[model samples]
Target: MHEDTAYPLYNRPWFSVWLDAGGNITMKGILAPAIKPFTSDLLDLFENEKPIGTIDANGMIVADGEQLIFSTWMPPIPSAAFDRLTRSQFNARLGKNTPDQVTISVTEECPNRCIHCALPDTDNRESLSPDAVKDVIDQVIGMGTT
Candidate 1:
């Protein structure tokens, strides 16, 4: 089981999800404008000593002069069992929690036309499958490893 957090559900493991005090959820693209490296140690956010928006007494997101409105809270990725998913990205396990960066190169087909090549005789060349490797990279980057 993952650790339960009291910080009102503004999680980044999945894309931005902002749940307010009235049980409302907003799936705004909050990443770009947000303070980077969200330490998750505070209930509020700030920018240049100015309160951008957020952290009401009940942890509701308060955008000045703007009424937060959204009828439904949709998960970025839908799930099968639950009618509503929480902020933990369905509790998906994370990669190593280290300040580490890695570059991964995947080889699809044998380059050398040797006996070890499965289809050496034919002209078979395979490039990196981006979609296939994206999930891996996402998980890795999610761990705060660039």
Candidate 2:
């Protein structure tokens, strides 16, 4: 494999920067094999200091000596949740008020506790009554989760 020197976006010697769609910045790989020997003091600097760089909305970034365009990944967020997050982000950035989606743990008692279940397979957990659940929903809605 050859390193593409033509484009230095993700080819930084030590660490490369990536920007996500939600306007979040993160480093690709801060610990490279070549820098393993000289990382004693560098590790602290990476943890405490924020990377200084300029990124524009056009997807262009200025880091080090050159300007580059970087790529980022976003894990699959469920459509409903993604819509809520997008709406909340837009409202936050624009100083607008909006209702954020509320996630309530209604029940932990699963009828089908399969072999590969994500939740704990405990049968002693008690589920909330329908009235209790409704009250919780009403309370959340009153708090602006509507």
Candidate 3:
């Protein structure tokens, strides 16, 4: 059994029968009969046009035969770091849509003391207030839209 934690589900030993262009069934491996019924149900669920069951708020597999294609929890609101990452990824895909952008780092609480840091090396570090951070984000968003 493939008991690796990385593949949370489908980490158990399962069999797959491959059929080539010609109609032929070749058994790959044998799994417990107890697992067979669940596997068939899962396949049916995925094959259907619409999802078979509902997904709970916590994002767990709440019901059998429920296929979860994609899920994400939206953060309370976008932080500067979050905005920057989103902008960068968007710019990479849609270069024409994204204008040339500059970033003003709001804080320097980096744990790693990189030698080439532009900020002064002092144990005492200051961060922008919540209001100041909000203003900076608003300005950036305005600039981005223009």
Candidate 4:
């Protein structure tokens, strides 16, 4: 399966430059904050180049035309609970976990034009019909999910 299918908002070049009010370029994502003017070297680095790097939830920065890119954030054992527990205990905890019973999307239609809303950007604007909603509730009840 494609990585994009497995993950939402996945881009081949997932990096986005943060810019200040003065139009000066800042570092990628939330990692680097200090703003600096885009130099000729920086422009060259961005073009016709797949700079070898790993950009995770915490982003990264490449400067001075270097091949070896570094991650801004280091993942610690994949989970915070790992630091306090043994491997066996961690496995047991996960094995004993219960998944969420149900997820109900009540409506897709919204009247408000909120600036942050992604719904307006999507093609789908139809909401579930009253009968369809009733059927969903009935099915949920039959499955013993609240």
Query: How many backbone clashes does every candidate have?
Result: 0, 0, 0, 0
Per-residue lDDT of 1-146 in model 3, one digit per residue for the tens? 11111111232247542222122223344664544554454333223133223333554545431223221321111224334433443454555354335456567776876787766576657788889888976786665521
* Candidate 3: segments with Cα more than 4 A from true spot: 1-99, 120-124
For residues 42-132, write the lDDT of model 4, one tens digit per residue: 4333333332342333544323221122112212222222122223222344573322244555666777668976766767877888898
Using lDDT as the measure, the top candidate is 2
Candidate 1 runs further than 4 Å off: 1-99, 108-128
lDDT of 3: 0.40
Model 1, 44-109: lDDT tens digits are 221112212332345355542122222223211122111122323323224323533455545546
- Residue pair clashes in candidate 1: none
Residue 73 C-alpha lDDT in model 2: 22
Order the numbered candidates by lDDT, best leading: 2, 3, 1, 4
Model 2 Cα lDDT, one tens digit per residue, 1-146: 01122222123556643333323434446554444344334233233233333343443553432322221221112223333434454455567665665555567777775777655656567778899989987875554443
| Residue 81 lDDT (model 4) | 23
- lDDT (0 to 1) per candidate: 0.38, 0.42, 0.40, 0.36
Model 4 pairs in collision: none
Instruction: Write down the worst ten-residue block by lDDT for model 1.
Output: 75-84
RMSD of 1: 15.8
